[model samples]
Every structure is written in C-alpha cells, then in structure tokens.
Target: MKEDSFLKNSVLLTASNITTGILGFIFSIYLSKLIGPVGIGLYGLVMPIYNLFICLMTAGIIAAISKVSAIYKVKRQYNNISKTIKSVASFNVIWSIAIGIMVFFLAPYISKYGIHDMRTVNAIRITCPAMVFIALSNILKGYFFGVSKIVVPSFIDILEKAMRIITITLLIIFFKANSITALVTLAYLSLAIGELQSLILLFIYYKNLSKKTPSSADKPERASQLLFNVLIIALPLCINGFLGNLFGTASTLLVPRRLASAGFDASTALGMIGKFTGMALTIVTFPMIVIMSINSLIVPDLSETISRRDYYNASLRIKKVMKIAFLLGLATTVVCNLIPTSLGQMFYSRDDLGAYIKIASLSAPIFFTSSTMFGILNGLNKQSIILRNSLIVSAIEIVCLYIFIGIPGVNIMGYGITLFISSSISLFINLREVQKHIYLNLSKSNIIIFTLLSILIFMILRGLTTNILNNFITIRNIALILITFSIFIILSFFGIEED
Candidate 1:
C-alpha cells in the first residue's frame, strides 16, 4: 500500500478503536453499577480463564494468518492467501470445539479449585460456546489485517461491542437477571451473540473481496502441508501466548487469595480485587485503546518495511509512534492523578475507586511505551523476544504480587506497583533489543519538558476548577477540567514539535 493509504488506514482504525473504547467504557460503568461490587468481582475473576481459553483456541492463528496473508498479498499470490485462511480456519475450529468441550466439563473443577468460587461455574460453562464464535471471528479479522483492509475488522469490532452492550442491557431489563450468576451468564451469552454477528459480517465482506480479486488457477497446496506450515508459524506464538497467559492468570487469581492471606476475608478480598481490576485499572488504561489501535495498524506496515529491508524508515516510524504514545501516556497519567477522585465518583460513584486509580496511573507511561515497543518487535518478526519478555515480566509480577500481598502494609496496591515495575523492565529490555537493529531517536529532554508542562497545567487547572466550582465531583466541574486539560495537551504537542 502507498504511504497515504497506510496513514488513512491508521486514522480509520484509531477512530474506530476510540469509538469502541468509549462504548465499552460506558457499558462497563453501567454493568458495574447494575451488578454491584460482587458481580464485578465475579466477572473479573472469570476473565483470566476466558482469556486463557481464547489464547488456546485461536493459538495465535490470527496473527499467523495476518502475517502470511500480508506476505501473499505483497507477492500477488491471491490463491495462497485463500488456502492459508482456509487451513488456519479449519484448524482453529477443531481446536476451539475441543477446548470448548473441555471447558464445559471442567468448569466445575476450575471454579471450585482454581478460582475458589462455585458462583463462577455456570458462567464458565456459558463462556464455552462463545469460544467457537470468537475463533471464527479471529480468523476473519486476521485475514483482513493481512490484506491491509482494516476498516472491515475495525467496523466489526465496533459492531460487536455495540451489540454486546445493547443485548446485555435489554436482557437485564426484560429478563430481570439480577443475581450475580444470572448476570454473568447473560453477559457471556451476549458476547457469543456479538461474535456471531461479527463473524457473519466479515464473512460477507470476505466473499465480496474474493469476487473482486482475480484468482490464480494454480493448484493449491495439500491440506496437510498447509496445516503444517501454518502450525510452524503459529505454534511458537501459541505456546508463548499460553505460557505467558498461564502466569498472568495465576497472578490475577492469586491476588485475592494473597489479599485474603493478608487478613481480609473472601468477600472483602474479592471486592478489593474487583475494585482494582474493574474500576481503577479500567480508568487507568483507557488511553491504551488508541495506543493499541496505532500499534495494530503499524504492525503490518512495519512487517512490509522489514520485508523490503527498509530499516531507516522503520526506525523513523518507531521513534515517531513511540514519542506520540509517550506523550499521550504522560497526559493521561497527569489527568488520572489530578481527577482520580472525581473520576471514580463520576464513573463508579466510589471514592475508593478514585484512590486506586491514582496508584495505577503511575504505571501509565510504562504500559503505553511497552505496548509500542512490543508492536515494533513483533513487526520485526522477533516473536521469541516478545515471548521472553512476557515470561520475564510475568515472573517478576508473580513474585512481586506474592511478596507485597503477603505484607500487611502493601495489600492491594502491591499489584499496582508490580504493574509499574514489570512494564518498565519489559520496555527496557525491548528498547535494548530494538537499539541493536536501529537507533531510536528518543528525545529525553522533550519528554521531560512535556511531562513537566502537562503536570503543571493539570494542577493549575485542577486547582482553579475546584476553587471556582467548589463542587469538585460535579459533572460540570469534571467537564471544565477535561476541556482545559485537552487544550493543554494539544498545546503541549505543538510546543514539542516546535522544539
């Protein structure tokens, strides 16, 4: 694709991601309020397991599909692309069905022993069918990404999220599913329906796109060989995903247990975990939606650049993207620190949620930067490095969670500190590896200045708003603060460009 087209695709995907993120954020707020802390806790507890299953069922096939498809598209081998998609999709479906069955049966054991909550058993079982739909959707999404048709996948994302929100709301109102188990089950079912909708939409798009492209009448590869090739590319990624997520799942599950060990009861510990994961961290990572969208769009471009041995351009792109991500992270950190209390009150109506957001916000820059670095590494085909980084960070996080959660003084905030340290370490390692290939033109002074200015502006405006408005947590005050902060953020960007 041309440079202009790449830029347009990036912008389109970013806009879609921002819209989806906003809708998802709003949905989360409504769900949290409707279900209360316990319901939120239950949902949070089930997520790691769900993610693990997804990682297993998809088996990194989506990424493998994208990479393979992109290469084929570049080589004008359209037939091979279809064969690749078909083989991967077939393999994914088989695995998803097998895994779904396992999950359906093992839900009781996992809920009883793994999570220590029987309340999640039904939710876990309900999540099983969703995996099949999710697997198919991922295959189509991967194909779209590979072919550089981001709009299809991006639109599907927004549609899926909207469907989930609408379905869940209607179900709750019409069915009055107020119990934690009922709500959680309904939530997972809505997810399944959303995936089905996305799958159907993408299938239609794929059919149309296929018809438009000329077919090479060449003979296709044998199914066995195709599957083997796909697995060669996918297995390592899948293993990396599985092991990394295994540790992450363990760490997440351990949080409440460790908190309990620190003197809290089951209910209190789970509730605290819920508050951190569901409310505080949600607010802290909201900016990542855009950052991640940028990463997604850049990966394929970076892959194409690397394929053509264009290191100079790739390095420049990395530096520019990372700088923007860094600035956004810094701005978000400042905003979070300045208005965590007000934010929590506004979003979840809980002062404690705001307090936790303050702690989590400190990790914002590291999280954002790490994501960018990881994208660069992945684009460069350094999957092993990415995997190693995940392992190292997961280990460190687990150890930190254990040590700090056991200490009475640290408690839940230990997770926040762990997040900061692990992300910093991962980013440091990624940067070191990245510099080996191309020197990153990172401006330390500019970053320092931007950080200082953002914080200074945020504090000044925060104080002014609070004094003038008096009601700090009111919607009007929050709106004024947001508008001022946004203006400062824009001005800061222009100032950096001038420097």
Candidate 2:
C-alpha cells in the first residue's frame, strides 16, 4: 500500500471514529443523567456479561477476515474474499443464533448467579439479540477494512450511533420507564435495534460492491480453504478475546463485592463503580478512539506488507503506530491532570467523579501504548503469543483487583491502580515480543524529549486556559485542546516532523 494512501485512509477513518465517539460519549452523559449513578452502575454490571458472550461469538472474526482479506486482495484473489465472507457469515449465523438462544433462556440464571444481581435479568436477555446482530455484521466490517473500503462502514457506524441515541430517547419517552430494570432494558433494546440496522445496510453495500468488482481469472478458492484461512487467524484471537473477557468479566463482578467487603454498602459500591467506570474513565478514554481508528487499519496495512516480505515498511508501520498511541495518551494525561475536576463537572455534572477522573488519567499513556501492540502482533502472525500474554495479564488483573479492592481505603481507587500496573506490564512484555521479529526504528531520546515537552506544554496551557477561564469550564477546556493541537501541528511542520 502507498504510504500516502494509507495515511489518507487513516485520517478519514480517524475523523469518522472521533465523530462517532463524540456522539457516543454525549449519549453516555445523557444516559448517566437519566439513569443516575447507581443506575449506570447497574447497567454497567450486565454489559460485561453481555460482552463476554459476544466475544465468544464475534471476537477475532473481524481482525482475521481483515488480515486474510488484505493478503488475498494483494495477491488478486478476489474469489477468496467472497468465499471467506460467505463461509464465515454462514458459520456466524448458525453459531450466534444458537448462543443468542442459550443466553435468552439462561439470562435469569446467569444474572442471579453470574452477576449476583437479579435485577439485570431482563437487560441481559435484551442483549442476546444484539450479540447475534453484531456477530454477522462484523464479517462485512472486516471485509471493508481489509479491502480499504472504510467509508462504507464508517458512515454506517456514525449513523448507527446517531440512531442508537434517537432510538433510546424515543423508547424512554414512549415507555417512561420508571424502575432501573425497565430503563436498563430499554438501553439494551436500543443496542439491538441499532445493530440490526447496521447489519442490513452493510450486507446491502457489500453485495453491490461485489457485483461491480471483476471476478478473479484464477480458479475460485474453495469454501473450506477460505474458512480455514480466516479460522487459523481468528481462533487464536477468539480465544485470546474470549478468555480475556472472561477474566475481565470476573474482575468487573468482583469489584462491587470487594468494595462491599471493604466496608462500603452495596449501593455505595455500585455508585463508585458507576462514577469511575461509567463517567470518569469514559471521559478519559474518549480520546482512544483516535488510536483505535489508526490501529484498525494497521492489521491490514502490516499484513499486506509482511505477505510481500516488506519487513522495512512493516517496521515503519509499527514504529509510527506506537509513537502516535503514546503521544496522544501523554497529551490526554497532561490535560486530565491539569484540570481533572473541571472535566468531571463539565461532562457529567458530578463532583464525585473528579477524584476518579484524576486517578484514571494516570493510566492513559501506558494503557494507550499497550493497546497498540495487539495490531502489530496480529500482523506478525503472533496470535498465539497474544493469547498467551493476554491470559497471563488477565490472570494478573484478577489477582490485582482481588488484593487491592479488598483494602478499605483503596476502594474504587483500586481500578485506577490496577489499570496502570497491568498496562505497563502488558506493554513491556508485548513490545519485547514484537521487537524480536522486527526492529522498530524507535528513538529513545526523542521519547524522553517528547515526555518532558508534553509536561512543559501542559504547564503553559494550564496557566493560560485552565485557571483564567476556570469559570467557563466548557470554553476553557475546548480552548486548551485547540491550542494544544495547534502548537503540536506547527511544531510538526517546522522541526518535529523531520526527526
């Protein structure tokens, strides 16, 4: 792939991701206001259980298809691309339908025993259909990413998020849901509706696009072979995702119980989880969608390069992705630290979230860096390594949460502590593994320079924006962000972009 085209596509997708993220973030603010903190906590509780099962169905399918499809597209094996989607879509339909049925039937048992919250039963049931919708829709998304046809999925996603907001709003107005269960169930119902719309549109677009493309001159690849190509890549990732989410689900569930053990009541514990996870962490990680948009393209870009033995460009891709992830994270850290309370009050209108936002922001840089490693490893065909490392970290995370959250004073602060430590360890291990295969042209001194300069910029911006317009939280924060990026853009053009 041409670097210019790759950069162009990345920029386009980044714009789309940021737009969708902003919409979704705004919806979260609305949801938090409507549901209140404890309700957000209850909603948060059932989501992990929902996500855990979704992982079981759709986990690595997208990455797998994207990688396999990119490699095939490079080799001009268009038939294989069609075959792969068909086979995977069929499998997903059967498998996901079965799983959805099971979840629907088992929701009550799972909610009571697995989540330890009987109130979540209906909400859990509502997610079963959404899981099925997502399972099939992902095949089309993966294909689009692999073929570099990002615009279709990007538009669809933006529309889906907007419709999601509208759907939930209408549902709430029409039903006037009073109890927490009724309200949370409406939220999940909106998710299912949104996914269904996405699935229908994506399938139509994929079909129309296929009809326009020239069929391969080469003999058609077998359905079995097509399935194998993706499964070989997808299964390891699926296991990694599934087990990682499994451990993640356990960690999430244990938080409330552990906090209660630490002397907080059940309601207070849930409220703490809601403030930190739903509000504070939500705002802090909102910027990560930028990193994710870039990383979404990384698997395909690196896969194509590696297939042609283009290790040089592959290394460049790796180095570039890591740099962007780390720097964006650092910028996030500086802003969060500079005005944590202001952001909390600005976004969610909650004073209690100030402490959580401050603490969670500390993990930004390391967590962002760690997240970039997954795409690089996938490009290197190190899915097994990803799986192994993820399991280890997942195990470590549970242990960390168990020990830390049980401590009385630590309470919800344990989540922040665990995030920082886990991300650092994951980054160290995964980065080492990646370097063994290809040398990253990473500059050590530049990273140090960048870190120090980021601090300096933070001080300068805070002095001007954070305090002077402190009363105007909205204007002050926006001005700080705009000025920070403007300076960085100017620096990049003059000196920073050179070396």
Tens digit of per-residue lDDT, candidate 2, span 1-499: 3898789999999999999999899889999988899899999998888889999998999899988887888889898889889999888999999999999999989888888889898999899989999999989999998888989889999999999889998999899888888988899899899999999999999999999877898987788888888888899999999999999999999999999899999889989999999999998899899778877888878877887898887886787777777777887888788778878888998766778888998999889989999988987889999999999889889999999999998988999999999999999999999989887747777778878888899887766663486567789878777776666544433223222
Q: Whose TM-score is greatest here?
A: 2
Cα lDDT tens digits for candidate 1, 1-499? 4678777877888899989998889888988887888788889989889889888877567777777788777778888888877877787888899999999999999999999999899889988888888888888877887887877778878988887888998888888887888998888778777878888898999989999987877776777786777677667778778888899889989998899889999888878888998989998898898788777767678888987898878887887787767777776777787777778888888877877888898988778888898678878878888788888888999999999887888899998899998889988998999988776656777777777877787777667766565464576545754675476557544533321
TM-score of each: 0.94, 0.97
* Prediction-by-prediction clash tally: 0, 0
- What is candidate 1's TM-score against the reference? 0.94
Query: After superposition, which runs of candidate 1 have C-alpha atoms over 4 Å from their true positions?
Result: 173-175, 470-499
Cα-based lDDT for every prediction: 0.81, 0.87
Error of 2 at 163 (Å): 1.0
lDDT score for candidate 1 against the true structure? 0.81
Which window of 10 residues has the lowest lDDT sum in candidate 2? 490-499
